[model samples]
Target: MADGGKVVCVTGASGYIASWIVKLLLQRGYTVRATVRDPLDAKKTEHLLALEGAKERLKLFKADLMDEGSFEQAIQGCEAVFHTASPVTFTVTDYQVELIDPAVKGTLNVLGTCTKVSSVKRVVMTSSMAAVLFPVTPLGPDYLVDESCFSDPNVCSDKKLWYVVSKTLAEDEAWRFAKENGIDLVVINPGLVLGPLLQPSLNFSVSLIADLIKDKNDTVNKNSRLVDVRDVALAHIKAYETPSANGRYIIEGPIVTINDIEKIVHEFFPELNLVDKNEASEIIPVIYKLSVEKAKSLGIEFTPTEATLRDTILSLKEKCLV
Candidate 1:
């Protein structure tokens, strides 16, 4: 185990990425205060409690993102806060009510609590590539998307890409709040996070993969910048631990298409039937690159796309999801 006496609070402890963050933090011997929607939810809390060292080092507290001051009890006395809790759904009847308010307001609520606690030295936030890349603009092949890029909320709203809008707005608010309050903030913007699932439920990204496997003709033509869940979890910790780390870091592996995923699935499990690349609909591949140099500087070497895909499929199989 790594040397860890520091106390840290992780919001949204029951989430796909947050669960891994909690697991990793416990492995390092940190006393973790994890916030979930309901501590009594067995499906969400059981796997967390089962983690190695969790019995001694992990504590779960109930916290609702939209509920003001709900995070205070969990965040008090923590040296650092890892704010990973946010809505991840794409299909919502009310985008503002279901996604935007929770993401933006919930973030401020967490930061507000942090301001009251003097022990908090830094806050590591989980933002998404959706904040960096959307509104569907055409870019040159040489144009590398970096942390500097911000998705246009106007465009996202007009396009009904409310999830992108929420992430973009929430991250924007976080930076503004951090600046005004003199808070040490580090944000990790991960691409489509795919790897082994720690939570019992299927997240949007993993569900996309599972849907493709279960359906012979369900292949998307868009390109996706992928990253392993474990790497994303480590990046959060790295951003928190590295003294010189600042601002935003884009965490991703490689840019791949749906066909690439299908090929990998076929390679690993030949018995499993998948959509043939030739039969899959093809659209003009988006030509752009994601810059991960800043994240790499934090000493995070990402997992290979093949290995991530393999692990993702294996995890789904283990859960009987695929």
Candidate 2:
């Protein structure tokens, strides 16, 4: 009943970013069909219902990432779909089985469904900055992977690297399917997504901050580029409107460090300990930084790194998480 098929479906609606996406869409008077693996699970849906006057405008559907036809049902009559439902596990033994199949296959399934659903005009997928911002060259401390870079799965197949492999392959599958099916798809690849978490269920992407806040490491260097979740959400909506934004859009800070994030958290929450003075295991996983030039050109604004970190601390405090 929405104008121009204005219904928007967001997969993984209970997630940190997807919840905010649903909130924003509902705030703008768009009917949002939010997908959860189990819609009846009151624990998950309760918080989402409480976000930004969402109780009435938001609808819930049971759409599992691995289950086919689930997305098809959720995406019915929707003009846009924000596919952000891939697993983000930290360790994996099989890239193809654990990471690749679900990430790639899940994306393919979504695209296939999008093709069947005639009303869907666009899809703003949540790809990671990991895919396009990784270095092809081997280890170099000076590596600040730009948008032109890509993670070479052949060169690196570590367990920790499997998540990157999944994202890269998943986005590739989406583009391939989009081109073949003639569906409009825009990918938003964010680097080390940070800022206030809207949901309790955060993927490993944002879990790094939580890990660091618990002082999981002492010498871990915080040098990966970061992006605010609110900005990333805005980027999704901006890409939906911008005519020239049908390609990959990487969102990130120029130079961000979790150490800097810790400093900010310490500013407001003085009792928090995001760092420890010990020689324990502390190696920051290397990930590609983002290039927000494309997004900026489209009028997307990014929050300052310090402000984002400060807000992150505040949000965690609000949730009583830290």
Candidate 3:
């Protein structure tokens, strides 16, 4: 038990990252108000309730991202708000309706409720590296991507990268709203988050690794910046607790390729059949060097890639998902 009196709210409490945030907050002796679509849904709420300190410290509230004023009950009397609920999908029939609207509007709805509540002191939002990596100008290996970088909305739109565009626009809108409304907001732009899943269902990031392991035809093409899901959760808490923490923090570990992932999985689990390196497609030469000095300053020592991948595989196996 760290401190017993502090109370905070976490949106999307059933999510891969948010569930860890809720678990950690409870372990630290903070009273947690976790929001989910349906509190009665065992699949979503059961795992959260089973956390070590959940019985004494966790409370679930029903909230929807699309519904305005839905978060008022959850955020009321909370000291800090962790806004982690946003639509995440790579495929969408209507980008505006499916991805962009839910992400951008849901963010504003949460922020709007925060503005009404007097106890809300700070808001920690989970923005993705997708928001920071896709800049308009092309860069070479010499260029380093940092928190200062912004993904070009026009480019994302043109490429039909709706997920990237959604994250970028939502984060941009968050900064603008925080500035205008005087809300103390801190955003964490995390890389491809991979680690053990607290939630029962497989998330998008972990599925990428699972796909590589299970699908023999999967090819190693583009490079990816990976970060442990636990590290991302810890970063959010640190950002809120540290008074000096401000602006966006790029939370990422080493940049790796699919072949790198396949090798690691083979090293850890020899029985598992993974993608063949020889049959892999032409690897994309492009790479993004992320500057995480700001996030480290908040006392976040990133988890090693091997440990992250190992834990991820173990978790998936435990859940019988791999």
Candidate 1 TM-score, C-alpha based: 0.95
Model 1 per-residue lDDT tens digits across residues 1-322? 3465689999999999999999999988899999999999999999999999899989999999999999999999999999999999888999999999999999999999999999999999999988887745646677779988888888888888899999999999999999999999999999889999988878888988888887633535566778999999999998988989999999977767777888877876788776466544464555776678999999998899989999999998898887
Using alpha carbons, what is the TM-score of model 3?
Answer: 0.96
Clashing pairs in 2: none
- Winner by lDDT between candidate 3 and candidate 2: 3
Q: Report the lDDT tens digits of candidate 3 across residue range 7-103.
A: 9999999999999999888878889999999999999999999999888889999999899999999999999999999988988889899999989
* Model 2: CA > 4 A from native: 1-5, 93-95, 138-148, 158-160, 201-206, 218-220, 272-290
Which scores greater on TM-score, model 1 or model 3?
Answer: 3
lDDT of 1 at 230: 96
> Which candidate order results from sorting by TM-score in descending order?
3, 1, 2
Question: lDDT for every model?
Answer: 0.89, 0.75, 0.89
Residue 32 lDDT, candidate 1, scale 0-100: 97
TM-score of each: 0.95, 0.87, 0.96
- The deviation in Å at residue 109 for candidate 2 is 0.7
